[model samples]
Target: MTAPASSSTTPINKQVGFINAFIAATLMGFVGFFARHIDAQGDFIAFSRMMCGGILFFAIIAYKGRLLELKEFKLSPTMVLSGFFMGNCLSAYITATQHTSIANAVFFIYIGPIISTLLAVIFLKESMKLATWFALLAVFIGMMMISGLMSIDSSGLSFGMQFSEKTFFGDMMALYSGVGYGLFLFFGRFRTEVPGDVRAFWNFVFALAGITLLFVFTKPTISQMTSTDWMWWVGIGIVCGFGALGTCTIATRHLKAAEFACVSYWECVVASLFVGLMIYGEPLSSAQMIGGAMIIVGGMSEVLISILGKSFKRPDNVTLKAGSI
Candidate 1:
């Protein structure tokens, strides 16, 4: 008896997805600010985030009387895999932040969009529009500029930079994080039958398990952590963990893998601006400023083109489920 979602509503849903993804990226940007304040190791920070977020999600589901949904939910391999990837991604990103400059870590982690785009094209069989390619190129070039790989000065534009031996490990970890994040996006595109909250809950659970295992091996001392450290952890857990992840899950339900990945580059721009200007008191170079603008423009252009370029066609494999905020 219920009417099917019309083509008109499809664009609106996609817009909503873009907005939620943008918000998630914004919340994620503040993660470094909280992580730096905590004296804990990356493993412990990640573990705490997952634990707290999982608990918060559980509480919300219970409050909404949606516990029945979990009871009826069947576990899927894709969901488990996605959750594990998310755990690894968070852990590696946090570790990278501790070892390398925020700019470098962010640059490496943002390679996720590229990875996701490729996987979506190959596996999801999603068509890549010319606009998407242009947006991706712009974003990649912007990231290069921001990472100091490409720079413009009074002399001219230069390419390449010296690598630091000290940050090599962290750089690798960030690259791994990007791969994990890409996989997370890819897998998240499947298992559409699961409600967003239920998926997020399991995501937290598996991520917590994975990080806990890592924590057991690393065994970083936590005795030095002050009350302030605990407070920051709780704040991050609530904001970036619960808030950001929840919105991101909702976004996955609405956007295609490649589309979500492209819009998610906003995270890098937000992170770079926040870490560079606010926390580090570092002045933004002309190149960095221009790079950030390009990223913003690229992301926005992708969203607009997706909405306006063609009629919405639902994928056969993916069910466009409506998610409650």
Candidate 2:
């Protein structure tokens, strides 16, 4: 028999992993700050983040002697297509950040989980529990509240319903990004042959190539930004590149799928909080605070329900099950 994680001092190690994830999320929150500083070069900033982050990702993998892992794949069109979709997701996400507040951007993109779950139910015949449905409903309501779409003031400028043309376009792009993200996850799950990390690495590589070509095609000049902006770009590389990816890999190692998903809710909150306090210094509206709380509560509720079901938990969470890539 093996030792329990709690008894083996691994919990402390896991706590360290959680801390990494928090820092990663927080640094990601600063994207808006960096974006605002670009001065007529928001598109370049968005493109460069992914390209630079992808380079950092590969560089780390090379240092770790995992470049040979890339040889295992024969490079099928399907994988390439999936990777292109993944690239689009990342590119669209960065683009969305330029158009809207990070709080709104992150919150809006999380519609992925809902879309992913529904897709699983329809395509994979996976049924969510009743509690999960409640969780979904709660998340939907929270999204509306956060987006300023749920209500309005008499002057047509309420907290939640303050939709302008730009806001609508931004939100729509974010929704598309979420769909690409959902499809990316679904496709990632489809690759039974590839290891998850290997798959992740290739996705990054594919994204680097695809987005770089697109970036060049767009003809963005990087000469306009300052040294400080480049430094922020580097921060985006380190924080989001290795930090988010590493924390996610480590967290998933010791966590249930529900646990992983539960902790992920923190990404949006941390992003939003950092935006509200650090970037804008705008106080959180009552609706936003309440909505944020609701989203967390809902995500946690679904996760806990999964845990309680034991047998009902996702295969990723089960100790003896064949793992997914």
Candidate 3:
């Protein structure tokens, strides 16, 4: 009798991927907070970050003559339009953070996964098993538990002095921002006929160029921006270039969609840590630490449950039921 073939399982690899995704998300989470200090205005901030990131990417692609990758994709126009929409969506998010508390913005913004995932199921006909649906719920609840922020901006300062001060307008902005960004993300996932690498690069480039034209019309002179401001803009650009574009693309290769979404709460937790350590240097609040721990446990539990369910089920048996997503 032939020896049984060995199964390949890599928990360590998966965990590494999770860490990568967490870092990416955490870096991205700071965008809203950073935008608060960008004096160029939110729309301009969006445009600048894209333009700077695009320029950096374009230079690299051009130096290596990666234009062929772009030329291979005939749907560059539609993809770029999608990117333009995404850039605007990002602008709206920065504005939302300004208008509302970070907690409200971050929390409401995530509701997009719910919206976009449903849209995907409805329009793209993507389906999940019952277990997956439960997993989704678990992941969502875990995220909410992780981001629990009842206190008003850690410090008891007045609304104007703090960034996370609760506001109705900010809440609305964050909600809409999440919905729009969600549409951008979940909608694009279905249209995978186009190369993701090409779309990611060119879409941002086109969006930057388009937004730049608009900026020119609105306020041509940017003389007010100092060298430090440019440095910040470049930093933001690098944040998008590597954090959003490079690292996320790499992580997606190793992560499933559901897993990626579920693991992303780590970003919020990391953001909280960054705030605690770098900006504030204040001790971690008990509520926050507990909340973060719960979120992680919940997300991991659901993922483990799904994996175990699949593992334990007979190969021929149907492991999942309908209405899962």
Candidate 4:
């Protein structure tokens, strides 16, 4: 009844996980588009996302006659903690978008990778070499450029002062979201024994609880939404909220924390593509073009190095698995 047994992941699973993570990232890229269509307060949207997604997840398990699986494992405190962080991440991100520029919000949320990297190194004992650090630096620079901050002069301190007072709070919320995301990633890897679905289900349950509590406190709105609004919320819940988030959690099973951190940058790149070509119908800015190129270069460098290193290792483990990295 509990989660599936924890087993050594095969090369195939790792590769699948890698693909899933990127796919999830791509799906997440369109979140803004959906947000534009959904007419609701951020907290309400956050709560609805968790509640709807969690319900659907459980519904799937029940349909498969796997509902009993919930009873097999007593939910751990860590699971509860992970859910709280996950909910906080979602709430903060949604609210951040309301207050800050999309670019700034996206960039700040990605600070999760750096925090995740530090946690993985200290607690998970993930190994890293100088090359990886250099790659991370490249990623950071690329992020700055993509966020449209590369042109700012730090000496003038004008950039810091430029933010409106109202937006400053949003920036902090985005930063907090990143920390919550880092903690969520850390706790997600705490128990490999749990199947990704089981973990995701419980995490959603707790996230729903937290978000619902927030909704109760905020009372953002009680007016009836149109059918179109309902449809948009449903799309977001099914696609971005459940589908994207579920795959992200599933990825933790096969990929190490640090590896996932490296891969997370793809979200920004993917989002930018959507924003530029589809939504805005604007050409890519020079900074965006340069930044996107660097992000790809840096991300691919790390992935290639990790994959090739693992593939060329001792004869005991010789495989050119794409996700082995």
Worst 10 residues of 1 by lDDT: 1-10
Report the C-alpha displacement of residue 67, candidate 2, in angstroms: 3.3
Compare candidates 1 and 4 on TM-score and give the better one: 1
**Cα distance off (Å), candidate 2, residue 245:** 5.1
Per-residue lDDT of model 3, residues 51-102, tens digit only? 7666766566667666665565465344555566567567667777678766
Q: Candidates' TM-scores?
A: 0.87, 0.71, 0.71, 0.85
Question: lDDT by residue for model 2 over 61-180, one digit each (tens)?
Answer: 677676775685456654565566656766677677667665566655666655655655566555566776777777666655654455435564344333467677676767777887
Task: State which candidate has the highest lDDT.
Answer: 1
Best-first order by lDDT: 1, 4, 3, 2
lDDT values, one for every candidate: 0.78, 0.55, 0.57, 0.73
Task: Show where candidate 2 strays beyond 4 Å.
Answer: 1-28, 39-43, 73-78, 96-108, 151-175, 245-265, 278-280, 312-325
Error of 4 at 214 (Å): 1.1
Candidate achieving the largest TM-score: 1
TM-score of 4: 0.85
Clashes of 2: 3
| lDDT (Cα, 0-100) at 259 in candidate 4 | 64
Residue 39's C-alpha lDDT in candidate 3? 57
User: Model 2, 161: alpha-carbon shift in Å?
Assistant: 5.2
lDDT-wise, the better of 1 and 2 is 1
Clashes of each: 0, 3, 3, 1
